[model samples]
Target: MEILGDRKFVEVPGTATHELPPLLVRMSPRVRSLERVLGMANDLIEQEDMIPLPAMPVEHDSERRRMDLAVNLVDQYLAFVQHWQWGHSILEWIRQCETTFDTRLELRNLLRADLWPHAGRSSFVVLLEDKLIPTAGVEIEKAVGMRLTFRQPPPLKCFSDQFLFYLNSSVAHTAYQTWAHMIPSPVSSLPPERFQFQVVNMSLD
Candidate 1:
C-alpha cells in the first residue's frame, strides 16, 4: 500500500503497471494533475523559446494521420510529466503538436471564408475623374453610389467563381453542338445528335 497525496493505493502482486496506472487512482486528481502539468509546461516552453513552427493546412489524408499520431504521442508523454514534473522535453513536444492542430484549424477556416473571393483581398479604393467616359458607351447614372471606373486590385472580380462560370458559359449553342459531335457515339439506340446535344443543353442550362 502506498499513499499519493492524501489517498492511499493498494498495489496488487504481479500486476503490470499498465493494468492500473498511477494516474488512474482518482479521476478528479488525474484531471487536476494534467491541468497543472500543462500550465507549468506552457510557462517553461515560452521561457525556453521552444515554440513550434506555424502549422499549415494538411494537403492529404496521410498528412492528417501523421498529425493525429503526433497527438497520441503527446498524450503518452503526458504520463511521464504527470509523475516527474520536470520533463521539459516531453511537455514542449506535446505543446508543439497539440497547438498546431488548433492553429491549423483556425487558419484553414479563415482561408475558406474571408479569403475565398478575389475582391476580398484588400479594402483599398480608388476613384476616377468625375468627367471620365466609358468606351463601352453604357450610360452612367448620376447617383453618388455608382462606381464609374475600375479601382479594385489586380485580380478584380474577373477572377471570382461567378465571373469565371459566366465566361465559360458564354459559348454559343451551335459551337457546343459542333464540338459534341466530333466525339464518337456510345452503343445506344439514340441518334448521335440527340445523345450529345442533350448533354450540351443540360450543361448550358
Candidate 2:
C-alpha cells in the first residue's frame, strides 16, 4: 500500500496502468497512487517533447511491441481527454500531429455539440466558417433555463437517435434539389408533331 495525497493504494504493475491514457489523466477515485507514480505519469507527459513519434526502433518483435505500447498509450490518453473534456487543450496536440507525417490523429464519435473540433487544425477563422451554422437545442423548458438530463435514453440507432445527422441530410437534399433544377432538360429525339405538346390526362387506377 502507498499514500497519494492522503489515500492508499496497492502497487500492482499492470492493473492500474492499462486504464490510464498517456496524454491526459482521468479524474476519478481510480487515480489514487503514490507520489512516485504521479511523478512517473508527469515524466511520461514531459518525455513527449524530447522523444519523436514512432518512439523506438521496431525491427524486432520486442521492439515492435514497445513501439505499439507507446503509440497506443498516447492515443488512449488523447481519446480520454476528448471524452472527458471537449474544449480541452486538444488544439496544441493537433498542431503537433500536423507538423509531422509520423504523428497520426485517430478520433472517433465526433459530435456537433462540441465547440469546433477542427479549431486545432486551422488557427484561422476562414477555414472554420463551415461549422458556424447553429443547431437547434432539444430543450424541454426554456423558461426554467437549460439543464441536461441523461437518466433515460431513446432507442439505439433509431431515426430519432441522430437528430443532427437528420438535419444535415435535409440540408443535403435541399441542395441536391436546387442543383437538379438548375440543369437544363433534355431535348426529344422524335419530331415535335409525333409527341403531344399539351399535358395528357391519366387515370388514377
Best by TM-score: 2
lDDT of 1: 0.26
Regions of candidate 2 where Cα sits further than 4 Å from its true position = 1-59, 87-205
lDDT of 2 by residue, 150-181 (tens): 11221111212123223423433453344323
- The alpha-carbon deviation from the true structure for residue 62 of candidate 2, after best TM-score superposition, in angstroms, is 0.8
| Per-candidate total of colliding backbone pairs | 0, 0
- Which 10 successive residues of model 2 have the least lDDT summed? 139-148
192 Cα displacement, candidate 1 (Å): 79
Q: Write the per-residue lDDT of candidate 1 for residues 1-205, one digit (tens) a residue.
A: 3444643222222332211011111111123344444444444444444334347754575445544543433343333222222112122322333343236432222212222221100100101112232212211121111111112111211232222224322322333344333433311111111111000111111
Poorest lDDT segment (10 consecutive residues) of candidate 1 = 119-128
Candidate 1, residue 58: Cα displacement in angstroms equals 17
lDDT of each: 0.26, 0.26
